[model samples]
Target: MTTPIVAFLFLLLPVASLAAGPGGVPLRSAEVDITDQASLQRGARLFVNYCLSCHSARYMRYSQMGKGLGLTDDQVQDNLMFAADKIAQPMDVAMSLGDAKRWFGNPPPDLSVVARSRGADWLYTYMLTFYKDDDPARPYGVNNLVFKDVGMPDVLWELRGIQVPVYGEAGDAHGAETAAIADLALQTPGLRTPAEFSRDMRDLVNFLVFVGEPAQAKRHRVGLWVLAFIILFFIVSYALYREYWKDVH
Candidate 1:
């Protein structure tokens, strides 16, 4: 049993390494709270306005999202139900797969479970790290620190502003000198300040986390009740055992 457990632990090492952020870059903490309804509302707005154009959340319905986020049916219908006529319909894209492939080289992936698969940290870092690139060959004139050679353009550029990479010298393989991105600098300011943009991104990540598990909050509540009942049962059982054993002793 010990040997089998040791072997299993070794097997998990590669999986842990593979979970590291892209290019071995450290991921920033999303610090998202799924219980924050206001943040989820903001994130929902951002997702619908930007991501829904290309990507679809097929597992998530407008009615479900509205109920989870404390939104009214009217609000959801008026603001979020763009691609669907009915509130019960799933959040989907208007862009066809063929058109998406032609434009983006691949169909944009469905985002219903993206938060679960990619993790909140990766998504947050990816959203924040897009910088201006002069590479003419690349479809998007932007690159990301988290995802190098990324195919998608920075859709939130208007809000986050144009950023450029600050390079520094680094030793590459074979002891050769190479330029590496040391940091990012804002080349042009956008409508929102850096602080405000960060806050909005947090909200967006928060919403994605909620979408990944809409019942998580309720589940937590149920879990607390279960634990409480278990504790109560244990106490009563112990009392009964003491009462019976006292007479026997």
Candidate 2:
């Protein structure tokens, strides 16, 4: 019990310790739960729908996802198997690297290990903070608070709605302009409320975390069993030692 609790805390610390990026955009805690299968499933659906068109999780396979997320082959094949021909196929896109680069001005990065590279909190905040841009270069552009002038548009705009940045004057008598987001104000109402959208983002991030290290939940389960075996062996060995000592005495 204590071991699991300790393991859980260790899992959370990376998110807990995340700091804001440049432009003073703070990170929101992701609070990803690898054990929440339902949440992960919802997140998987969201990822496949919104992100899979552009991004690829090349290292992750549909078959591996079924095992990791406790889905049956049929469930995975029917629901999550979009671009992959076989269940064992990796999560790659139909779009080639050259096409993606031409379209987006740069190739979209593979997301297989992104959660490990950029902590979950960063992803969570970035997902939530995309706003309709005011920059002249991309006046209709959708920019991210965390990564300014982000290439990817607001893919979840319909679900979470359009957010516009709330700016404030800072650090000068003449009031210099800055891209820093003081707060986010939803410009258009979406299918889900802000609270609901936050939960959806949480689920999406949770799935990413699960994909980043599919064995994490399994490791936790196996660790408990391993500890139990060790304890039982120790007790049996102690009893045998006591019996041998009794005969000697």
Candidate 3:
């Protein structure tokens, strides 16, 4: 009984660590489902079109992604390959390091493990909360809700639409002073409706999570089987122990 309790507590450790957000801001739950092939495909397409130019997932191979997402080689080449030349190649960006530094003030970090480094919820909220910037010298005219004064521009602005920050009564503490985003209003309509955009972001985050650990789904399946075997073996051993003890009694 004590051993089971200890095992249960150990399982809860990872969940407890991820419960709090940075600066105590609540991170939205990503609720990623790696088995959802359609969502992964949509995320892959979105990533290739909007994010691939700047960010590289060099650790991920296009063929591996196709297999994981249930995409055919032809489909991946047609839809998920924008700047890349072939389906067998790694996900490399066309932008040079010097060019990226000059354009964005710093090189965009590789996103192969970003989903693992930053929780899915944080990534989801970070991508969805880009509001129009108040500053003039800022090239992108937008900033993030989660990451204040973020250097990267809002690349999905056209798809998600422009957002304006709404300020509450001054000194509300959760206002701009704390870099807290009180609220955001849609300033201009985008290609997708609000609901559609949210779904798109969710899908994108899901794909990023999958990319971070391509074998995650398989690992989970294997883990379940292993757990079942352990339980079955334990039950059989206990029964045998009882039978052996009955003779002695």
Candidate 4:
């Protein structure tokens, strides 16, 4: 029984690795500039336009988004909010999990904690790594370097264009893996260039960061006071310790 169980576990390893895709890269810290209101605003717009179709930020409220992005209730209602939205209600997309699973084979997961779950850099890299792969089994026929053979379609492919992998010697001593975008081409030339595209990704990541911890801004603001108190406590404790040591000496 133990031998069979071990064998089964070994079999799962490759499948798990494949599930992780090319580099088995997970999400990591990103240099997303959340302080930039314009960038955050742009990210909010892009998220509603592109991502809201499939994914939902169930943890966030529409009113919270409006407040964070400096938009009025009217603006959020007119432009960003979809469905029979109530300002106090959590911002959930209309797509049901069952319908999503039926359509995409895997239900799109809630993205409220995506930044927390995958980190900023992973999301950033995943967004940029979609390349063309003519696999019928794949809904998008696209592969990602970070997520590997992901089931989700590359919805931004038109704006980012197709990418092709640049491979190195399979079992080389260095074991290097590299890929580059073919011709730096985009299916449609947008207002943004490659650098700008990276910036856009950063912005989207910022919104995710915001969603991950709604109180993060407040927490950070309070952290300084906490740190100062801790420092003072440590200093007082050290002084008491020194006095005791001196008396003993």
RMSD to the true structure for each prediction, in A, is: 8.8, 8.7, 7.0, 12.3
lDDT of 4 by residue, 60-169 (tens): 88888888888898888888776536887787788888899899887888898887656677788788777776668666778877776787888876666566665534
Writing each residue's lDDT as its tens digit, candidate 2 over 1-249 gives 357546644664434544566666678999999999999999999999899999998878998888878999999999988888799889999999889888888688989878876879999998998888766796348888787778887889999998888875544666655534578898899999999999999999999988889545565699789777866776677679878899788
* TM-score result, candidate 3: 0.75
RMSD in angstroms between candidate 4 and the native structure over all alpha carbons: 12.3
Tell me each candidate's TM-score: 0.78, 0.76, 0.75, 0.68
Error of 1 at 161 (Å): 0.3
**Residue-level lDDT tens digits of model 1 in 1-249:** 356445644653535434578557888889999899999999999999989999988878899999999999999999877788999988989999999999999679988878877889899999999999998977889999988888898999999999999987788778887778888999999888999999989999888888889544565689779766865676677679888999889
Worst 10 residues of 3 by lDDT: 12-21
Count backbone clashes in candidate 3: 0
Question: Which lDDT tens digits does candidate 3 get at residues 179-205?
Answer: 445788999999999999999999999
TM-score of 4: 0.68
Clashes of each: 0, 0, 0, 1
Best by TM-score: 1
Q: Which residue pairs does candidate 4 place in steric collision?
A: 21-148
Alpha-carbon error at 210 in model 2, in Å? Answer: 1.0
Candidate 2 RMSD to the correct structure: 8.7
| lDDT of the candidates, in the order given | 0.86, 0.84, 0.84, 0.73
* Candidate 3, lDDT over the whole model: 0.84
- Which segments of model 2 are wrong by more than 4 Å? 1-18, 173-180, 214-249
Where does candidate 2 clash, by residue pair? none
Better of 2 and 3 by lDDT: 3
lDDT of 4 at 33: 71
Best by lDDT: 1
